[model samples]
Target: MTTIDHAVVLGGSIAGLLSAAALAPRAHRITVVDRDPLPLEGPDAQVARRGVPQGDQIHHLLMRGQERIEELLPGIGDELLALGCEKYDDVADFSQFVDGAWRMRIQSDLKVTMFRRPLFEWAIRRRVLALSNVTVVKGMAVGLLASSDGARVSGAKVRGAPGGTLAADLVVDATGRGSRSPFWIEDLGYERPVERHVRIYMGYSTWTVRLPEGALPKGLAGISASASPANPFGVAIRPCGNGLHDVAAYGMAGHYPPDDLDAMAGFFEELDSPVIADVMKKAVPASEIVPYRMPGNQRRMWEDLPRRPENLVVVGDAVTSFNPIYGQGMTMAALGAGVLGDALAEAGTLDGLAETVQARLGPLAQVAWDLAVGADSVYPQAEYENVEPPSARDRDRARAQSAAQSAEGAVRVAMRATALYMDPAYLGSPVVQETIDRWLTSGHKPAPEVTDPTDPPDVTPGVVRAADLLEPATAAGRLAG
Candidate 1:
């Protein structure tokens, strides 16, 4: 196979880092450019920065995501686990409430680990920078540089650099959700890719709180309550490190979670279960509330464009941005990098590389896109364009199906738990589909063996006094006595 002399990668966060890793072996030199100064500190750094506005929010590295990252950067998982990140069976260790009922805690091999987004990115940045062929250049990419015939991107125009254009054999756009590749492509006299959007107007708030190690019972490291149209809100609490937990409350459409502590507590109290609310009342606040808003899920159809540059490709959130609530961003980014690596190995050179990689990326993202958009479309207030929204009847059917799937012995939970690591089509396997159908129609089945046999114990931490507290809801009344 032929090897490229040099390649350029835009953005230096998770996506850019992984892109560099994938290209390093095939290219003699690689330049990773980012507008934000790359963090040099290692994994334990807790610095929250603006480059990734959602850095402080609760982050879930799904089962598949963890495995993919480990494959790219070997021993990375053990390094993270050594830094106090908790690893456990996502099915057995987490207590989840979806479609209004708690999911049965059945033991499974699916594993997931919890860590802060900033810290995780920091770790990846360190590994990518360690590659001798990869050099991180700090600057913003103002535009793309096309070939003499204007049919391919030769490189990018770096703002405020010694030379106007940084030339390379290939240019990658990993600038994330705010990427301007489509506009740049248009200016280069090529057709812009069609785009799709699903407007959810989601607002979420997060807080980092401190609690004693093992403050709760054994075998429980995370708890979550999913949002539905009936409730329009949800909450998740997971352990980050050093006895610190990250709690996040979210609302869909116009029901935004408040930025104030007392008001935030009120939102938690309103969840179907008191587990998160009780933790909020007792846990000592370690950080102020940080709120984030996402306009919607968007996908740029680069694969559909009839005319495009042969040397340029987009990856990560730049191509497909999903609703962060589903935790698909990081995993999808890794998947894109893998596709790029495979395409390069096949082509033997940069000729016809961009189109091949971009086309392959679309299907890799479609699975996660379907899951996120399908789930979000059920809400009555969400708006979408260029896509068919789920009908009212469809929403009702979905809710009923979800409730049935949440019941004990259902295979759907296990299927979803492994979605990121396996093919999204696995959810449609006859075994899983038939299981859901039988549960819904027959209404009788043997229950799966429960990991936690006893009922949840009352572990309410006493409420503290504060004048700013939102009007008290019957807090104590919600918990078991």
Candidate 2:
């Protein structure tokens, strides 16, 4: 095993904290640096801070991410719940409207824990700080310190208390989308990573509201309506604990949701489903309506560079930032840390660790980039280079698959892919294809409406009920048979 004397992680958010945790077992000492003076205790610790602009936004930990995080920091799920987080079934307690129809609800083991971004970060920050070898420094990382040959990073240059070139055996950048790593690397005579951008022009307006008891239909913990070209507006409402829910209205292609509360409610009213708008009628706004916008998805092709500093690796949004609408940012950050850990274990030394990890992270980031950008490509205004817009047939195929959510098997595969539990190729598997065929033959009827809040969910027509369908073994068995 290669012994790491010290590792310095830039940025103290989810990615930075998780990176520190990943380094704790191998490195003798790990220091996490961030611009914000991270709160250690009290109510302030659990709420949005100045550093994290999106801290007030809604965030959820996908089942896969939650599992990976639990592995990195055991009992974190329980701790989050103790701190007033809410865990709900991914399918059973959720409602979604897509492709001009309501999707059939099916019970599944996939769980999603909901919390504001700040609380989630705080939870991980607390756990990372608990490790005897890990400590956090209040500082802003400005550049990289390199060895005499400039072949490896020696430390980081910071701009606050104890600020200087903090020497380390390994340097990890988790500085997010605004990172200056590229310029710093270029300054060291290394090639700058190629950047890819997809212009989405997406906008979001969110509010934290206290819903009246039974505001949402019974058995439904959250509701969402996906945005499309036909109806460019969408709404997502999810529980954020303490009797509060985060309600967000989003639009794409310059059809930005209004910041005014009344106008935002009006925006929801335009969605395909009236459920969200109706519920908003009784929701008491607990916080100011917050608005955020994104230019598009951006990614740095670090692996494509012929050479990079050996002891440095960039993680999280610094590598690739997806459109926030997909909610893949935090999950991807956790997975990136896992990749970093894997690279460390495989390399058995710091030499060439950065290059190896960058190569591995490329494919991982491509998964999310493709998913987010593919969906965004549907809009004519979405701009990208060297990538063709999805053909009409492709669009039709996607729409058909979405409509196929009327079948339990189809819903299982689709939701699993959405949760990042399976490869998207599973969407084209024999089972999903067969299910889609069955759904198409059945006229693609929309899910029945439930007029009453306490009424049982309506089962869709031509449904295929298979309890073991979601299991990998069962899926493989079906493929073989």
Candidate 3:
């Protein structure tokens, strides 16, 4: 049986809440600490809290993430759907443009949920805090509390408290990309973990918009255009909920998207596809364009540390903060929660738990890390640390991967596997390899029917007011104000 009694989880974002869920069954009591106050009400009360600055950004549950979440909190999928989240085939209902071409969309089982990030996080947090054993404390965690011997983390030190130390049998740091785990561990007399960073200098400006009544052209639930070196700009437009769509414009290497709606339309004309631009030109803006900037992709190599606290482990963005443009953080967090549950079940004790769990979590992040970094390498000014520059061979491989995703047969399998969070190596399977090889040799030709082309759809700017799209209940919600 697990020896854990009370555990402390820092940062109550999606990651922290999920970590609490994973430990709640084994630990007699779990206290989740956050910089932002816990959401007492349901998803309706949820918004981009001060804790998650990017909470207002667009987000989705890739199929695998959807499954993992369902496993942790049964029927969450249904709850979200009933709450206005849209579920659709990832490829069939969504169009992804890469390498100046649209990915072949096909009917498949791979599906994802599109909803506001705050609502989803709220749903997960609500469920996690509902566990009788779990409690949430509002505060900012400053450091780790270590035993006198400096071998095991005994608790956490918050900025303000009855004293300052909140004791625990275990400490979980889910403080996200700005995590101070390395500094805290080093302060506790352990060596700092090595860090790897890939700088893309990414920027985002997202707006809530109202689309035409029935859906935009060919029933496409969403559209994404990946940024290339030549263009250096990207756009992602997806339906959030209540007939409102979240349109985000991003750029790589410091080419920030414009905040002005008209300028944004002009920015889209430079993209590979005019679909998003056309829609944006016609959609009614429901909210101001909110901008977010990320320095780059970063990962702390804690698993490589020779010595570490036995009763502590870091999870989620704290470990690997991937480029948010890929929408991998939430999914990776869910997977890490599952891995933590497995590690606990295997060890049955807190002894050496940090090392064992951190090691396993490293592999879980490798696939997403590689995908993000490899894809980001295409930009002109991409920077790297603790990683080598891409060679000609590396560039060729990246190009080939892009071509594979652009092809029909290969992309279907590759995309489905990726959406399901399968190993990136699966793209190297015999079937995928064969399809990619054939496409390469055949001069990169897509099928005759690349898409279900719809008639030139009518899009009229200011046709639908913001008041018409958003539910009155959300009037006092964060974005509404």
Candidate 4:
């Protein structure tokens, strides 16, 4: 265990509770400070705090993350499953049309648990608060307090009923996107961290339904991906308490799901596919449609900032947030806390924990970040286009817009090609669509069709059936007519 004395966490969301849980073993004392009074365990009551804006949404915790949580807080996943969080093999259990092409569910080591964000986090927070070394304090952290040298954060100054201050050996910011740690650091005379934004003009709105848990569609436990690029969408037959299933209708704002029953009907009718819309068709409304607007993905350059003060670090969405379409936020944050635990152990129970923590989280967070930007950068929305919008005037506007649309089309082609090219027998791949999505997201050279990979490298995309090796793919019905 690291010999650190006290670690103060500034947010009480999943990230905050998980951080406390991870650090509790190392720190002599850990306090989780939050602006709102987090909910208690009960099905009859669950209210969103003023602090947690998108608290009540159909959120999915990736299976890999559930594994991490099980490792950190044993039996936590099972406990969640018992508490209405439905489990399914996310990528492996469900076949996906990811890059394009209906991807067969290859038997892999990945799974996911679909749950309402508040209930899941509340469960974890309860477990965290149970730790003898941990405590949850109700207050809003306004700023940080540093040592005499001001080289490291000693604690935080919080605003509460009477306003107060709490000092600690280390300070972790678990606050979500609106975190002020960067500005606070600048005030402490350090270079402000840079930020990256991938604007997709996305919004998530959920409608509850009273479909019997057993009657829900098969393979309906998690998100069923949509194939349309213009409407890259997600549908969840999420399990809530008491046999309740939340048939969440999620889409980008320009094509947002409506709250009224008629609009709701129209919403599903317009989806790229009829699968999700059909499910919503039979579902009985348990509650009014809840609409929440969440804009572009914003990630702080916390890791890139050199000369970070001692006893100070940021974790969770404050550090980096990905496009929700990936359903990686909770899992990624849990993994981050797990890394923090391992880092504290490696730093040898010493004063350098803050610096080491960020280093460990960078690689993990970057994986999600790179994937999000690579996809979101290609969105067709006018505002989310590249950093530099067209400054040219006159008919050039139409020309540039047309060119952008063409590039976007090429992007989808590339994504589809990437999906198809991997299939050894899929006529042609590389040349036509490779990297089209990237080009669409980020203006680049026009995508051109290229020859398929060197005849056939050792590996191909489809499931390698025993029948495939001896004959052409047609025998397996994997090839086009």
Q: Which pairs clash (backbone N, Cα, C closer than 3 Å) in model 2? A: none
How far residue 449's Cα lies from its native spot in candidate 3, in Å, is: 6.7
Candidate 3 residue pairs that clash: none
lDDT of 2 at 377: 79
**Candidates' RMSD to native:** 9.6, 3.5, 9.4, 9.4
Q: Candidate 3 — which residues are off by over 4 angstroms?
A: 42-44, 392-406, 422-481
Off by over 4 Å in 4: 41-45, 92-101, 106-109, 161-163, 212-229, 232-236, 239-242, 382-481
**Candidate 1: where is the Cα deviation over 4 Å?**
42-46, 213-218, 391-409, 412-418, 421-425, 428-430, 439-481
Q: lDDT by residue for model 4 over 1-481, one digit each (tens)? A: 5577888999998888888888887888998899777657565236556677676666666544776788888988788788876665432344232332233333222345666766777778778888999877888898889876779888898887234888888888999888999988888888977876667666667756776443433344433444235665555556655566666666653556655676677766655445556566667887776766667777776677778788887888998886565566887778878878888877755577777888777766765564455455454562432234323331222222112222333322322222111122321233322233334345443223211111101111233232322233333232221
- TM-scores, each model vs. reference: 0.87, 0.90, 0.88, 0.76
Give the winner by lDDT: 2
lDDT of 3 by residue, 1-481 (tens): 5757899999899888988888877999998888777766865457788768788887766667777878878899999888888777766676777665566555656667789888888888778888999987778899888889898888999875558779999999999998998899889898988999999998899889898865566677877777888888888888887788998899899988887776876798887777767777778899888888889899888889998878888999999987788778899898888778878888857898888889888876876777678778877698999988676545544445543333444544445335753354455445445554565566665444443222222221111122321232322221111
Worst 10 residues of 4 by lDDT: 450-459
Candidate models: Cα lDDT each: 0.73, 0.78, 0.75, 0.61
For residue 35, what is the lDDT in candidate 1? 74
**Any idea what lDDT model 1 has?**
0.73
Error of 1 at 291 (Å): 0.9
Better of 1 and 4 by lDDT: 1
